[model samples]
Target: MKKTFDLVFFLLLFALVTACSPTKFATEMAIDALTGAGSSTAFTGESDPELAAQSLPFALKMYEALLVDHPDHPALLSAAGEGFVSYANAFCQLPASMESSWEKQRHMLQRAASLYLRGRDYALRALETRHDGCIRLLNEKRYDEALENCSKEDVSDLYWAAAGWFGAISAEGFNMRRMAEAPTAYALLVRALSLDEGFNYGALHELAIAVLPALPEAMRYRPNVAPADDPVRTWEADYYHGLGIDPISDPYRAAYHHFERSLKLGEEGLVSPFVAYAEAVCVPQQDYEGFRAMLEKGLAVDMETRPDSRLVNTLQAEKARWLLAHAEDFFVVIPDEQSEE
Candidate 1:
């Protein structure tokens, strides 16, 4: 009888320990169909752009269900926000088809802007999970409250969130509704720079390079504008120094700086930066060689650091298609008769 009681007690204790173990829970979750391993399988298919594009809405729905269970999950919120932004920009609003119809392009661009704003809202909610209320305040257009909430600790998310907000404003134009939100966006970006100068691997520097020089004199009161001589001098100085020269009136300096930084980061096996650099910087500048170099480097790096980086592979395939389509324009011919003459 004593031996049986001892055995029963040991069995119960073992069962309790196993039930509470985090590793066990994680392993179980990893295989769970609803919220675990199956989700990873979905992500694995993202290597194909067409498949990824098709799967995005499904993936987002899965995330939404997970969020219902784990309502405040930061990763889920970030994924959802980023998905909307990407889908809107990459598929809906691409300006390449503008040659066919400007009206269609304009409508698509408006849709992209709406999606970006939605992304901003979701990102703001994610920030709230970390107790950084700046995101919420920024959305509310309470600049002073937002600035007060912002601190050095929140720099990473703050940088990205502010960039998204500002990009939306820039792309869509600042009406009264957006104008109310502009100050908070400006203050948050300023705080991001103050906290971490190297945030986004100096992508902010490129933004400054692009916007400051061409900043309309009238819009200086809006976010991200400053006197050319402001003491904090981050964006301007980094832009000039990164490019090794100043093109006072040229937006191309920003493009050059961003592309260079992307190349530098991608060589270190950071693939997304390379893709972004190619799309946002190189293509905009019509720097076909630069774009090709960045894309090739991205593919090489993706094979190492992020082997499953679907976006990198997509960018590489796109680059190949682009090169094939524009081979004639990309190659220069020197006629023998002209050379002799």
Candidate 2:
């Protein structure tokens, strides 16, 4: 009887160990699928976004399957949410050329928005697992309630929650349902600043500069400050002007500051900031030379800091291809008289 019991116990222990091993494999598979793991081997050094994008759906499916077994895994939840958003943005929304039909663009945008909303929800779930009540209040658009829940010790949570709400609100069109939330979006951002001034790496300074200057005359009223001492109007001038905005009303200045900061930060292999800077600030200002310079610098730094940085490699190569394809469009010709002068 003792011998028989020992054999049964060993069998059960082996079964448990085997089952546990698959969970790690599933987790790794989920990450690999999201990040284009083996795809990096194909090009010797760099991965292709097109190929990476193709792998995303399969990876996402793997993540979903894994979630069935490990439902509350933080890493899995965050990865799944981000993967959905990235796949939607990269494959669906970003490929529309000017020649593409309007219906296609509309469909893509809507899909992207939905994916972003999913990401937002998942990120919220991750927060909720930690018992963060601020996220719940923010989701309900109860800004004051959310603010009241915030403490100085956990200000980062407050900032991110407000940012998440802003992102969700911005994803919608001018529907009557969303219209009421517009003012609240701006207010929430302000509240985030009040709670944590360093939110967005202080990119809010640029955001404020960009937004305040473009406000319609009537909408520019300083409800947040005294009539004689409105801080928003002055902030619009100071930060924007410092960033090289001519007439101090240009939104592009805000972009310039943020992009510059991104490039500086990308020294450690953060590429999104550099790419965003190029797209939002440099391209809009017709600063092709500056854009090209920044991208080259970004690529060099990224390579040095993280030679295996797959996303950085892909984005840099794509940007180079873009510059090559649209060389003429990016260049401006000066008149002969102006050139001579």
- Top lDDT model: 1
Q: Which regions in candidate 1 have their CA more than 4 angstroms from the true location?
A: 1-45, 66-73, 94-107, 131-156, 166-251, 268-306, 316-341
Candidate 2 per-residue lDDT, tens place, 78-115, comes to: 65665565555456545532214778776766776676
The regions of model 2 sitting more than 4 angstroms off are 1-46, 68-71, 97-99, 144-254, 268-275, 282-305, 316-341
TM-score of each model, paired residue for residue: 0.58, 0.56
Residue pairs with clashing backbones, model 1: none
Model 2, TM vs. native? 0.56
The positional error of residue 264 in candidate 1, measured at the CA in angstroms, is 1.2
- Per-candidate clashes, comma-separated: 0, 0
CA-lDDT, candidates in order: 0.54, 0.50
